[model samples]
Target chain A: MKPTARWIPYFLVAPAFAIFTLAILGPIIATFGLSLTDWDGFSTPSFIGLENFVRAFNDKVYTSSYGHAAIYIVATLVLEVLVGLILAGLVSAKRNTTFYRVAFFTPVMLPLVVISVLWSFLLNPDLGILNRILDQVGLESWKHIWLGDQSTALLSISVISGWIFAGFYMAIFYAGFQRIPSTIIESARLDGASELQLLRQIKIPMIKNLTEVAVLLCVTGGIQVFDLVYVLTNGGPYDTTQVPTTYLVRVVFRDQQMGYGSALAVILTLVVVGFGLIYNKLRTKDDSVVEY
Target chain B: MFKGKRLIAGMAVGLLGLAVLTGCSKGDSADKVLRIATPSLGDSELPVWEAAKASYEAAHEGWTVEFIQQDDDLYSTVGLPTLLNGKNSPDAYFEWAGARLDQRVAEGFAADISTDIESSGLKDLFNDGAFAGYDSGGKLSMIPRARDVTNVLWYNVDMFAKNGVTPPKTWDELNTVCAKFKSLKINCFVQGNKDLWTVGNWGGHIISRVAGEALYAETLQKKKPMNGPEFIKGLTVLSDLAKNGYVNESVNSIADNEAASLFFQGKAAFHPIGSWLVGTQQDQAPDFKMDFINLPAITDGAGDQDSIMAVFTGYIVNAKSSKKTEVLDFFKELYSPENAKKIADSGTVLLVKSLAGGTLDPLTAKINALLDGAKVVVAPPDTGFELPVADALNAAQAEVIGGKSTPQAALDAAQEKVAALK
Candidate 1:
């Protein structure tokens, strides 16, 4: 290529690189620096030198927030990922599945704030439709304050998250199901394989790459969940639903403890990165084993 | 080709420089703007605010009045700070008078407005006691706007009459009334503890009565332990109400407005909230007959039974603002006699002594009477003390009210968290 032609590509990417540096990289670097100081967003920050990190480790609420996130991640894996795979299999087996596909994917199109607010009203104990329906059906014994009780608040949020994203995962897996060779599926059916057997043995194994991606997406997305939880629970019912982001917001915004909040943000970033790395490593090892 | 490359490079550099400049740029300062930050007002009072703005701008040529209104919850917590730290901070901002005001003053955001009040003749409108606690060694940092009795037991007048029960005046009587309402298949008391402050404010008053006002202040101000026996005793008052199922079962899940809806729909017999409820009811439930009474007296209580949980909320001139004179002029117009009357007619209890009487609604007049008779005025935990300590106490109250912990256990957990704050 000519020398000027070689410079064209670099010129085209420069603006985006500058934006990335200003918006993303700058904040990351600033957060790291702020993590080492005692600043309340107004006063001049004084060097505190890892005291914020020490306090975070000792902070019960901040540390327990991770435990809540773990529960949420596991729950989403089942409700969003596993459930989506099952839904995809069921929908793929049916003829003319457009209606089912559209109905399932509808929640994903709605904004998270709208979904959270909608579910908050539906779950309200006194005047909410959920409890009222239970009473009307003579199932009052099974009714609960779904979002208020500690035993149920986080799980309820996970269920709502599942409801919103299960369709997204299903659409992904359904596309994968469509990409499977029709001849191989027909041959399996001709050999007397049941639909379930085709899905479990043939279809799922053929879509291993898609499943890996879906699981990775679910795990990371669960870790960074904020808006839905903030609107629905605000980490309430005695911090039972306190995830890392909600707790970070409370510390930084509400309490104005910017230094400590930045430290918490850094810790959360490390955990997310660590999970991503471990997942990639395990996937790569599995791929090698299969090749051998 | 070389010329084209240089053009591309110049465009990229211009884009980067533009982004940097945009991020650093402040709002237009050449317009002679007087900006104010306040909590979003309801429909009844918003017109008055707009009128005040128009009046101010009309009186001063080339002057523009800008109001930054935020949701009530956000205004008190994150929103105000974010705005104040931004490049175009408001000239004046609303703040509750207590530790929050003191924090702003300490952070150098509040200007001493005493001289402005005197020179502007705003001092003649309010009583001397209205400026109490606003002065830090005679440096007045805030101008009083409204005095809010933060928590009062507002009962449905028709519901009480139908049930043949009078308003409760003592602890046992209150419990009896709740029991009677329960027997009638009515929710006795409905509160949205979802944000924790509803129960936190009410429970703070109960704590003040049981543990005494001084100890309540001492514990929440971080000078004493929160899990003391008297504090535990105070929490039990709230826990028993929860255990008895007097409050709505979804208290922790719903917002304050939702709980107010239950009360308005006659599904609940009583709602405990701030003085703002009167105006809210006027707008939201115009026909619902309601009256409020002070919290019931506790027998053998260490504190004065007549103590009321109240807070003074007003605006502080930003110390960094270049338009202090403009802000004062706007304030003078905002609090003029006609606007003050409009605010009063909307069921708000203004701190202006001249408009206190003869213009209030019947319910607001009763509230003023309560204020007049209050032996001591107590500030709620969240507005009166540090945020962390307030969070701890509020969470403890929520835990106790939600039946998640015994009062002792909850206060112990809270004390642990408060200790960690040090």
Candidate 2:
């Protein structure tokens, strides 16, 4: 390529960069700027530097909501990655992986709000099919007020969110599994390696990059989850299901505390982006040492 | 910080300049359309608006009426402000007549129609309390279309008869009724407390019943501390209801609309909700023999037994719009007894004192009588207070109900939080 052609590459990317500047970076910078001012959507924004952040640290609801987000992110990550990998491995082991893959991926295709609402009815303590089935199976004691009880509400919502996105991770892992050389797996099997041993030693190690991608997607998605929780619990039953987004919405729109909510948004972005950068840095260093 | 302010100011000026340029390019129309936005309830209100629009357009020449219907959530969160920003703003909009309207008025969105409403002899047409929310500093920003009684408990007659439980007249009697329903594996009162507003409404009724509307309002306005003895005791009644499982076990899981659905499905014997439920019940369960009753007075309580929690829900004109004359003409036609009759026929309870007398169904007539006997009406906490304070009160109520905090502790926490709100 000519030296001027390299300039053409930058020129070609300018529109995308401008769009990003206007759409993403602008809002993020505006939010950070607004975090220092007490604006209620209307009226002049009065600068209240560090007050919103200071209040956020002292505010029990704010702190607890972030804790809930952490819980939701961790729970969703474990369920999605672990279950997704298992389902991917099981489906790939079979000759007819197409049907299984399609079936697993169906939930991801459905709207998150619709699935959440559907799960709400299914998990309802009264007249829900879940409780009815439990009654018929003589496990009536196991029936719970799934989205109402403080102890179970966050976990139950996480389970639903994880269930919806599991298929996406599953598809990624299945593709990862497909990329594994058949000879390596065959040799492992010939060496008397069990299916579990083959999966742990060969398949998983070969899919490290795909696994990393899956983890990153799951973590970011889980951290920013709003619609399912909003549709189902709405940060209720004593705000037990409150994540940052739900509480931020309450602060911004409902409560009209725009500055405080902006602070929350900024903090959430930092947490998510910070985690991504750290993970990338560590992974990049490890890959450099691999000397492939 | 100064740079940031200047940048934002520059952006605002640029936007305003752009809007002015656009306005000049479009030019003004001789026959202007008076665009009115209303939230769609999928009920009789839409038809009423249509009828009003037609009637108004017929009377006024060289003018048009446009009804922009929005979903309730969008109307509040985005539509209201977007419509009010002096760019293609609707001449008028329907909004809940309370703190929401108050907020709009404070933000200079709601026009004060006090003189127009009164001089036109229209103010006399509505009930005194109909203007309670919109009236401030001798100005009426909005007029109510209907008086919503939100705290009354309605019982299914068939369920009550089958269970051999009569409507309770006191707190102890209510407990007995709940126990009877429990024995029959039926929920006593169906509640969707997850929304927090529902819990707040229930708490409002109990608080009004115990501490009276005067004290409740005072406490809410911060004229009196919310952590007072009366307030704590009133909240205890609500805590008892949740802790004792008088409400549905999954009360905190379901949405308010879903809880009402469960009530209509005969899953619960008693449903405590606003008068709006009557319209929904008529639509959803036409044959369900339901009768409305007041929340039983607490024994030795200071509040009047006849008093109920009632508030107005209605429309406000956009102060920023240039179509005030056209909007008033529409309101005049809309508030006429003829349209009021249509609204009443649609199963809504009207609070227009002049149009109060109507040929209504047996159930509605019964509810109207119950409303008439009310000595003093109280606003629901959610509608009465600012959103942040209301939200704080709701969270506190949830804590008390969920057994996470004692009633006193919750109230104390709420008092502190609300006091801190600007």
Candidate 3:
């Protein structure tokens, strides 16, 4: 390569590194220094060593909130990828699919805060239209406590989450399906094979990389779902709906426990990195089986 | 020498600003100017900022009164805590009792005003037992809102009379009335426990009924274990109400105001709420005829069957304030019978000595009279825990009502957290 061409790459990368250091690395470094101290954002920070972490580990609210985040991520991610892949296959099989595109891709565009506020009213016990529908169906007994009871609160929030984002996953899968040549699918279908036989034998083997990408996105997004949960639940009804992000805000801002809250943020980052490692390992094992 | 030089610099800048400050700082004040900061819970008396600026101007003819009001404005949204940590904060901020006050006192975020109170003549006026209820370092950290308010069980007089149900006096009687109302398909009690404090109110106030003022105060304010008989009895009363399905089903996120809407709609026959609701109702639900009744005593209660659990809001001037003397004088004027009457007339049962007649809401009057007659008044039992402990207990209430944990388990969990506050 010419000397100037090599320098072009460095010039191109400088802005990106500047942004990364200022935005991401700056906060991480500040938070690390904070985690080692006892600062309530006012008094001079004293070296407290690991006291904040000690308290966080024992704090029931923190533990309960992370548990909610785990359940929220696992349930939503699995459902989105599986349901999304199927819808994508159905759409991509048809020629020139504008209708399918519109039908499956609009809901994800709506803002999450708007969805949370809308659902709060929709699930209200007395004023809500949901119970009214139950009454109409002669299922008054099944009208059920919706947001109030501990049993249904987590699942209810998950359903709203799934309903909002499934469309985006479907669009992702549909794009991945389009990238594969039609001949592979046609060649398999012409062999007098059943639809399921075609799906399992050819389609699945062809789009494994796209499936990995979809799973990765779903895992990352599911793990970080905050705005909807924050507005709707605020980690209440006895912390059954508690999520880590909500608790972090309460500690750092409302309780003024900046050092302790920073410790929680660092731990949460490790959890997301752990999920990424598991996904990468599974993907590597799947990729080892190369087609001849 | 270095410290003296900086002090001289500070004096130079402070002197450079006397013209601006002579706005709120009166001539007679010892020296300092005062700034007041408050999270504005809407007051019709002053549309928050306008009222604050106007009143500060009126009272502080010479010195400046910087009124930093947090409305729905984003400035307050982001600035409240950061500004609190600045070299100086508001000389006085309007304060309401409970964690809002307790948390500040515990964090060493507030200035001690015991000396100012002793000198103000207002101390003797306030020389009642209110200050003795809860003390921090043997000093009254707050000058409390004038009257004691319990969560009153308010019912529609017309509805109770027509239904042939006398209001309930005991936990069993409450259950019976609730059952009768269920037969007629009416919600007997209204609450919103989804957010936790609603459940805290369930034990904090109703527990006062079951345990009586003395024992409830002993356990809640005195740091006595909740496992004892009085605390156990109080939890049992709340758990029974929850078990019977007597509580309004809409409570999770249906805020307190929404519950009031239920009574206005006549969907619920009674609401267990603070006495101040009468003030809120006159403006929010004028057509509804509301009446108050005490929580029926558990037999062999503290002093009288009529006593109610109550909390008070209070005010204090900054001891470090340069205008400390002026702020004290302004407060002394602010709490006079006439001005305090405005507070009472506006809504609260004024803490200043008894105000003129019409200013008192009938329900407010009765609760005040009831307190006057009582041999003992209980602070809600759970608040006696130190700051973090009280908060943890308040937070754990959600689990108790959800049946995720037993009352003692919940209280114990709260107690453990309280003990950990150190």
Candidate 4:
């Protein structure tokens, strides 16, 4: 090869590398540098060493925000991923499932802010339709302040997250199920396998890789949940629903504690990276690719 | 190989040229433009802003005035700061006249507009008290526009008349009225604490009344512990209201707009909020007749019984802007007596003394009267003090109201947070 050929690959990759450095890598490094200083986004940043990290450790609300995020992640794993798997299986089994598919995926098409605002109205204890319906059905005793109570606020947000994204996971699983050969299903039916048995034994097992991907997506996405919680509860009813992102935003913008907020951001980044690593380690290495 | 090196060097030179050109384009027309940043105004208020923009531009040949409007909550917190730090920062921006303005001044975002105000004849337009808190150690940093009574007990006039209840004058009378409303299956008061500031403002006033404004200031400014007996006593009032079901059960879930809707819909007897509710009521529920009273006096309280929770709001010229004279000129036209009357006619209570003479809407007049009657004026925690300290107290108030924590325990937690801030 000519000397120019060796530089061709570098030339081709230069733009992308430069963009990545400017956009993603630069901000990460800047945030880490910021984490070490006592800056308020305006004044000269005084080097505070690791004081912010120590403050984070001792900050009860900041530490509790991680706990809320953990709950949200666990809740979304079952609510989004598992529920999505069942929905995909059911939709795959039936003929002319277009209506169900569209209805399920409709929320995924709308913005999360719009969805959150809509659900906030629906869950409103006084004027919302949810409480009104309960009253109408003579279930007044069952009506509770869904987003106000500490016991229910975070879970309500998690369920709303599930509601918005379950369809997304379902679409992925449905696509995976469609790729399975019809002959295998035909043989199973001929062997007297019930529809439930076919779904539980064959279809679900076949979509294992898709389910794993969905679970991973849900876990990472759950850890960074912000807009939905922000619009709905705003980490309120006494910070019961405060996740790391919401807390980070409050500290950085509302409280104007840029250094502490940057520290929180760094900690959140580490957490998300740690979770990704753990998920990778625990995931089964089933190298057997399904043939078409 | 020589050709390849030439090609690489040419590309590098081209990229450098493009970067310089791009940078030049940003400032090409920047000198002739004046940008104003403010919270998104209502449709009725937009015309006033547009008129000001037109007037300012018409006065200066080859000049343009730009407005960057953002949502109110976002504007105060993240939006204005982001804009100030951006490539094309505003020449002037709207801000509350307390800790937030102090912050902007400290961060070098606010200009010393005292000379501009005096030279432009804008100083003589308003009452002497209008510019009360717009300065720091005699260096005026902002042009005062509106004197807002931030928290008032706004009640439906018709609801009060029909229910055979008069506006309460004391804490016991307030409780009796709430009890009467409760017996009739009505929420005596409705507040939305989702954003925390709604209750934060109201609770701040109550704290001022019970604990005295000095201690309230001390606690929120981190000079004293928040878990003091007076602070606990003040929070107990809020907790009792929530526990007795005087306020809506969904106070912590719903937004302030939703709570106002409930009051408008006659689902609640009273709504405690800022003076801006008059404009909101006019826009959202045009036919809803509402009147407000200062918070009822607390018996045996340490603070002035006639204290009012309020804040002045206005615009500050950007300290870093080269267009300070132009911004002041624009304000001269925007806040002229004639324009001030137009704003007052639009249901806003202006700080202009001339416009305060029997020109305001009845509800706004009542609010002005309440402000006039106040013996002590206490600023809300969120606007009057450091945000982290305000947030701690607000969260503690929410905890007590939500039945999540006792007033003592909640205040203890808040004290801990405040101490951590130091």
Best by lDDT: 1
Of candidate 4 chain A, the 10-residue stretch with the lowest lDDT total is: A283-292
Full candidate order by DockQ, most accurate first: 4, 1, 2, 3
Q: Over the stretch A171-209, how does candidate 3's per-residue lDDT look in tens digits? A: 877766666677777887788877667666666667777
| Candidate 2 lDDT, B1-422, residue by residue in tens | 66865786799799999999877876445538988887774666678878888887788876788888888777766566656665677888887776677777887888889888777677777876666656755578886666678777888898888767788888899999998888888888898887788778878778877887789888887788888999888889888987887787777788788888888889998888877787787778888778877888788677777787877677788887777767877877877888888777887756786565668887678777766666687778877776777777777887887778998999888987877665
lDDT of 1 at B183: 94
Which is the winner by lDDT between candidate 2 and candidate 3? 2
**lDDT (C-alpha) at residue B56 in model 4:** 80
CAPRI-wise, candidate 4 is medium
**Residues B173-259, candidate 3, lDDT per residue (tens digit)?**
877888999888888888765545556665666666666656655555535766566666667667767677777766665666667
Candidates 1 and 3: which is better by TM-score?
1
Give all candidates' CA lDDT scores: 0.89, 0.80, 0.68, 0.88
Residue pairs with backbone overlap in model 2: B150-B274
TM-score of 4: 0.94
User: Which ten contiguous residues of candidate 3 chain B have the minimum total lDDT?
Assistant: B72-81
**lDDT (0-100) at residue A123 of candidate 4?**
92
Better of 1 and 4 by lDDT: 1
True contacts kept of 1: 0.70
Per-residue lDDT tens digits of candidate 4, residues A1-292? 5544677788789999999999999999999999999987767789999999999999988899989999999999988888888898899999999999999899999999999989988999987888899999999998989988889888899899888888888899999889989999999999999989998888888878777888888889988999998998888878888999999999998988888899999999999999899989998766774532
Worst 10 residues of 4 chain B by lDDT: B353-362
DockQ-based class of model 1: medium
2 or 3, greater by DockQ = 2
Assess candidate 3 and give its TM-score to the true structure: 0.78
The candidate 1 chain A region of ten consecutive residues with least summed lDDT is A283-292
